[model samples]
Target: MRQRHKPWADEFLQENTHLIIPDPSNYKNKWHEVFENNNPIHVEIGTGKGQFIAGMAKQFPSINFIGIELAKSVIVSAAEKVQESEHANIRLINENAENLLDMFMTDEISTIYLNFSDPWPKNRHEKRRLTFHSFLKRYENVLKPDGELILKTDNRGLFEYSLVSFSNYGMTLQEVSLDLHALNDPENIMTEYEEKFSAKGQQIYRCKAVFPNQK
Candidate 1:
């Protein structure tokens, strides 16, 4: 789906740089300084409209949440929600996930969330998928030794592909849910897409995988 352009997106970002961090690469290993605490940092790579990240921040006050979104128009809405929530533990980054290594150091992140990411189903676009090997490599580098990656999607093909990808990467699957909503996990924070898809009777898939510790 094409993103609807917001004419005031630039202005909104300029005014709310605090909520949606500008030049996040500058933060690097200093994210704790940005949050003003040494709390564990959890990142949601495709933070659509800010619902999940904001909700997670409210749910886990001791953990710092950072949302990375590439779309200017979409991220502006996310920033608005973060602002309205008045949650100081949350921050937004208007940047691409491919640049994760540039913005964080080794073992800098505690957990990574991939929610309803673009499936990029074509064989030629396999590398573009967030679960692709290159992206997983990046995640492994930035994530702490004990850190785990959590993924949620309604797309079965993508879910299956990710399971294979994680296995090939030598990551251990901590948990797998074929029908996440059926489990009615109270701790589960639903993204806007998850809520919409679940309302339409679509089954949600979720998995948590941790990287093998380096010897």
Candidate 2:
């Protein structure tokens, strides 16, 4: 589902500017300072409409959360949601995941979340998938020694590909769910896509990829 362009997107973002960092790269290695505490930091890539991260922030008030969305128009929506809820533990960033390393230092992040990312079904476009090996390697570099990535999507192909990618990258598969909703896990927080697809009777796939301790 494509998002409709909003002429007032920029203005909305500006009004909620406190939610977003104007230049995240400048805060590299200083994210803890940004949050003003030593609590672990978690980030969500492709944070469409801010459902999961916002929920996470409310659920775990001790941890700091950052929501990254590439599109300005789309991020405006996330910012608005956070602002409305007055969630002080959440921050928004309008940036591409490709530049993730530039904005965050090695071992700076405790966890990363990829929720309902584009499957990029074409084989030629596999590298662009969020769960692809290339992205997994990048994630491993930025994440702490014991950090993990949790991915959830409705696309079976992407989930299968991610399982293989994480294995090939030498990461540990901590947990997996072929049908997330069926498990009835009380701890599971539904993303915008997860709620929509699952309500329609679609099965959701989820997995946690963890970096092994360096021996």
Candidate topping TM-score: 1
Alpha carbon lDDT of each predicted model = 0.95, 0.88
TM, every model: 0.99, 0.96
Q: Write down the lDDT that model 1 would get.
A: 0.95
Decoy 2 TM-score against native: 0.96
Q: Kindly report the root-mean-square deviation of model 2 from the true structure over all alpha carbons.
A: 1.3
Stretches of candidate 1 off by over 4 Å are: none
Instruction: Encode model 1's per-residue lDDT on 1-215: one tens digit a residue.
Output: 78899999999989988888999999999999999999999999999999999999999999999999999989998988988899999999999999999999999999999999999999999999999999999999999999989999999999999999999999999999999988989999999999899999999999999999972
Cα distance off (Å), candidate 2, residue 135: 0.9
